[model samples]
Target: MSRYPVKSETCHEAVDLADTLLPGNAGVTRAVVLVTDTAQLDLWRALLTGEARTSAVPVVLRRHDRRSLRGWAQRAEVFTTDERLERLHALTGGWPLLVDRAHRLHVELGDPDEVLRRLADMLADRSAVRAFLEATGVYADPALAAGYRSVAAEFGGDQVDTEAVVTAIACEIGDEGEARWVFACLDALQVFDREEAQLRLEPLLQQCMALGV
Candidate 1:
């Protein structure tokens, strides 16, 4: 297997590189392509056409400029900006990759507890959350962020505050479903007592029910 999944611009180049890197395999199913300029469209088109040969594996593309990949939003397996590549690799290449995407979203919660707390407090305050989400462009649609703020404001300072924080963060990050799951778990009051601290999760469940999650 290749040390890194192939990154190529042209179909022929990708195929040749894949064959050279993984001799026995006829082609590579998974790929990463970086499109920095519109001048590379011919190369991208060729790769897209050739990728049909191994459609089973996903071909994710990262665009350096939004204008360069505007037409490919629907075709690319996972569209992201070039600025996120390093973070993406760090998140997806390690043991964490073994977890499903939803689990990964939750796992991130443990990594940034302080940030989550701040976000939760902001969500509880409509004006603050709205300003924060709007300034950050958390959701593609500003209305979605507003909706999340509305949902979050319903239950503030409750035991589910932690879950609410996680939900608000996820919503801001465009992972609404994971946010709902976390909220649901909190509302259920499912406690997981550990040596460090007692974890309560009833607020999440209540929030989920209220949001029709």
Candidate 2:
């Protein structure tokens, strides 16, 4: 199990401290710190590759991709067949949280297709998933917002946020082409949707981006 740092401390700082202590005269060869957030991943990319000069190469960055997701599925023990395994991987696009949710849903529903359907339903109703979509900051763009106005209209002026409304439309629509288009919009907005299904958002970010918060 991964041990989290104190409330006031940052994960990067903890990683740096560990890296510093690992090298000296000890038998330990190297240490790796994994960061999952796209924003934080971008920050680390800039920090590690920035123009600043450093004599020693300290940190190495690696991303979790489709291959990694396959390994993760094996470890999760949720996918019994190759087809289901591939479907799960495709549906999640290697997003860890989505994969975890898919695994949980499979455990509960016991039907692979049903898991996907349930995930689609959860994208609209789950607060945590809604928050994840909001973190992508797609709603801030006027053009994108205008483009999704029809989908937003489906909500009938409900108090629900734009992210949730658009996602609900995507899940509820039957036309594959239109669903694909909606998924593309979500992708452009940086909204989190796994294979055009199962949108996710971080709650803290959702709160941060809330109106008048």
Most accurate candidate by lDDT? 2
- lDDT of each candidate versus the true structure: 0.36, 0.49
Q: Which stretches of candidate 1 lie over 4 Å from their true place?
A: 1-29, 33-132, 157-213
Q: Candidate 2 — which pairs collide?
A: 131-201, 132-200, 132-201, 132-202, 133-200, 133-201
Residue ranges of candidate 2 with Cα displaced over 4 Å: 1-46, 52-67, 124-129, 134-213
lDDT of 2 by residue, 57-133 (tens): 43422223556766776787666577876666555544556666787887888877889776556555557555544
lDDT of 1 by residue, 1-213 (tens): 123333344434664564445445667365444323223333333443343344223233221223333223224323244543333322222111111331344345543333334434534665643443233222424433443454446534233444555656475556765455433332221211112333332232223223431
TM-score, every prediction: 0.20, 0.41
Q: Candidate 1, TM-score vs. the true structure? A: 0.20
